[model samples]
Target: MPDLKDLNSIYLIVAFVVPGLIATFVRAQFINGRIDKMTDTVLGYLVITLIYYGFSIPVISWILTFEQGLLKTALWWGLTIVGPACFGLLLGVAAQHGWLRWMAKKLGLRVVHGTPSSWDWQFANCYAARFVMVTLTDGSSIAGIFGTASFASTDPTERDIYIQEVLDVDANGIWNYRSEPSGILILAKEIRAVEFMKEL
Candidate 1:
């Protein structure tokens, strides 16, 4: 029930939307942030679409000022897609590595929608050297020193963590083990909190 213009607009929207989603995924994976939430994904796509236009418009106009004709039109359209995608990829990588995150925090851009932005990558990056206390939703807890290869997930409902040289804690909230248990795997969905251990 739509006309050619409507369909063309939909296609144009998809062109920006797909690349934006990919860029968001790339950055989220890099930072170990959950990307499966529908609201987060939809908001990311919309924001990226706006960013595409925000970046493309000025560059296209600047380029058009240098040339005029059908060739200029072709150049404008081509640059609109290619330039933004390349820039977005670089931006995403920077964000994943915590550089952009640090800058955002420094600029007071840390919280969004009443929630502080916390990435699992921050935990994964620092957990190797410290002891971790993983408390589960079922009231069971495990404490351990994680190996360097242990990892975290980007999915909130489905994350997995590995801990090596696990220490056993008694019923009274005291560690009772002088020996390590087997390596443990903790699922993020089952976990309630991860408490970092102070230096012993």
Candidate 2:
């Protein structure tokens, strides 16, 4: 026969552990920018916790009335195992629906995709007074100039330029390259603007 104290302790442990496990699983499945995903993940976890508590109270109360011995313990174990799994699955599904992508756009970040061209390299060496390497896919932008061709690679259809420094360009089309992280070399022909960053 489980005592009242034992039942209470078991319930408390289940209540805490279930939500935590759910939150952990949610975090693991979704990979994106940290700040954006974290906010949504926390909000989801809170809602799941509330729902679990609300439903469990009535169910546990009813179970306690019928089976007075180890019934509460069994219920606690069930909730601990099941509650988090369900919540984690829900969060994982929500994450796949462009949640992080939308958040990145909201924050004035966008992704672009393109291959490099030979003309781009020529432009970099000659006409490209400076260079700004913008990673449209990752929403990361680096600025530098055509210091030198650190490395180069290409396929039958495209070329890539690895710039020693990233260049910065203004709306006026002025090139201003500065010393920054080493970036990839891409051909100019392959360069294509995919997305834009709107003011958030």
Candidate 3:
């Protein structure tokens, strides 16, 4: 059995948990609902924390070998935590930007453009500056040109978008914005579907 009263052992527990906590938070922010369950999140955090610390240990060890005072030691410890976090964040960004797709193409692999992996990228890339009809869950809809759309990387299900030149659909189902010609805000819970119109 291990000695529970040891101070170093407590620090070891903290060291083990900190990386996972930071990794999980970063990944949750970046990937959003990709991790649905608590168990999945915990498992993913453990795996990523392991991978990060595996690479970080040697570098941290080498840096700590340098002579340092109290302040410098604290700075090194800060670096140890921040370095892996920055790396994890960069990885998340690269993943979101379709880096994998780009790599596959470079390797002579064929993949479809406008893949659904990154919904925010897809919306901003494909739908921005284009006309669309946002159908609400209650059977009403507003058509307009997509001006600025905001995506929730923190909560993937939260669909919030902004529209310019807001149009009202007549009983004949035609859209006209001449009367209003203002902006409209749409929320996710109210939206049922989005119909793409002509590109501008």
Model 1 CA deviation exceeding 4 Å by range: 1-7, 14-16, 33-46, 61-85, 90-128, 136-141, 167-182, 188-192, 198-200
TM-score of every model versus the real structure:
0.56, 0.33, 0.63
After superposition, which runs of candidate 3 have C-alpha atoms over 4 Å from their true positions? 1-10, 33-40, 101-129, 138-140, 149-165, 168-179, 187-189, 197-200
lDDT of prediction 2: 0.50
* Candidate 1, RMSD to the unseen true structure: 5.7
Question: What TM-score would candidate 1 get against the native?
Answer: 0.56
lDDT of 2 at 151: 37
- Residue-pair clash count for candidate 2: 23
Write model 2 residue lDDT over 43-128, tens digit each, in one string: 55556677666766876676667655586767666666666666556555455444555777899987441113433323323422
After superposition, the stretches of candidate 2 with alpha carbons farther than 4 Å from their true spots are 1-14, 30-48, 55-58, 70-72, 98-200
lDDT of residue 63 for candidate 3:
69
Per-candidate clashes come to 0, 23, 0
**Per-residue C-alpha lDDT of model 3 across residues 1-200, encoded as one tens digit per residue:** 23559988767644664576565555444444244465446555567667777878787777678777886777566654776578667666665576867999899997775323555545635635777888899998788777554332334557676676677778897876676468777787887878878877
Ranking by TM-score: 3, 1, 2
**Model 2 weakest lDDT span, ten residues long:** 191-200
Encode model 1's per-residue lDDT on 1-200: one tens digit a residue: 22437888677655656656655655454455435555457666768767766867777567768657887867765664565557556765675455766777899887432112354545635633667888899998789775575565555656677876688777787865555357778876788988877644
